[model samples]
Target: MSLTDIINAVVSLKKDEVVENVISEINKGTQVDDILDKGLIESMDVVGAKFSSGELFVPEMLMAAKAMQAGLEVLKPHLSGDATAEKGTVLIGTVKGDLHDIGKNLVSMMVEGAGFNVIDLGVDVDVEQFVTQAQTQNADVVCLSALLTTTMPVMAKTVEAIKEAGLKVKTIIGGAPVTEAYAHQIGADGFSDNAPGAVELIRKLMAA
Candidate 1:
């Protein structure tokens, strides 16, 4: 019946309630922008905070993101072009030789929830694809994920390729094996170990 109801439903990871509340808000003639911003997006912000504070875990965060996605689906049809204008474009994918995606998938959802237009290139993505997509999509940031130590070298190669290509896009890397030191050693623009921190890092990179 209210935006707060939608927010609560998302925070509680109730997909049905979130969808119901979103539909109710739309039926009540609420602004789609308000429903998106004050309702769904704000819910993710709260979820992100809880995650940072250790009150939520990956499974819980995934559920909350799913709930938020449900609300977004209902609102999508009603959303005006301006209402869905993204803050920036983020190109995310797992580097070549690594197929793991739980962390990548979580970061993709979290980044999208934060209002960035995300292009997920899936697993085993090579440096050529990364460079090509960044150019074609006009991405503001390229996020590389690697779950294996062996695959971590590809992150560096991709970063080098992006820079060598003379593209202005910022590059970020993450995964269980990735560290700030490795990110620096590889000449990446930023690094994050968790999804929420990835969102924050992207925001900071965009602002810079």
Candidate 2:
């Protein structure tokens, strides 16, 4: 019935309630931008905070992201071009030789819920595909994920390729085996171990 209701619905991971509240708000003549920013985006911020504090885990974060996505879908058609304008374009993937996707998927969903235009390259993505896609999509940030230490070198290779290709995109690395030291050693712009933190890192990188 209100933006607060939409926020609460999303924070509580109530997909149905979030959808209903979003539609109700639109019917009530509420501004699409307000519904998106104050309702949906803000809910993710709260969810991220809880996640950072360990009050919520990956499952809860995924549920919240899903709830927010549900509300976003309802508001999309009503949004004007300017209202739905993306903050930035993010290209994300699990690096080649690494088929793990849970962390990559989580970051993709969380980043999308945070209002970025996310292009997921899926698992086992190679260096050329990443460079080509970054150019093709004009990505602002390229996120590399890896679960196996053996595949971590591909992150370095991808980051090198992006830079060598003269692309102006920021590269960030993450996954269980990735570390800030490795990110720096590989010449990446940043690194984050968690989904919410990755969203925040992307935001900061874009802002800079």
Best by lDDT: 1
Clash number for every model?
A: 0, 0
Global lDDT of each model?
0.87, 0.86
Residue 32's lDDT within candidate 2 is 76
Off by over 4 Å in 2: 1-84
Q: State the TM-score for model 2.
A: 0.61
Question: Model 1 Cα RMSD, Å?
Answer: 7.6
Worst 10 residues of 2 by lDDT: 76-85
Per-residue lDDT of 23-121 in model 2, one digit per residue for the tens?
998889988778877888778778878987999998988888888877876775565432155798999999888876656876787788778899999
Tens digits of per-residue lDDT for model 1 on 60-160? Answer: 98899888887777776564433156899999999998876756876787788778999999999989999999999999999999977899999989999
Candidate 1 Cα misplacement greater than 4 A, ranges: 1-84
- Over the full model, what C-alpha lDDT does candidate 2 score relative to the true structure? 0.86
Model 1: lDDT equals 0.87
Q: How far is 144's C-alpha from truth in model 2 (Å)?
A: 0.3
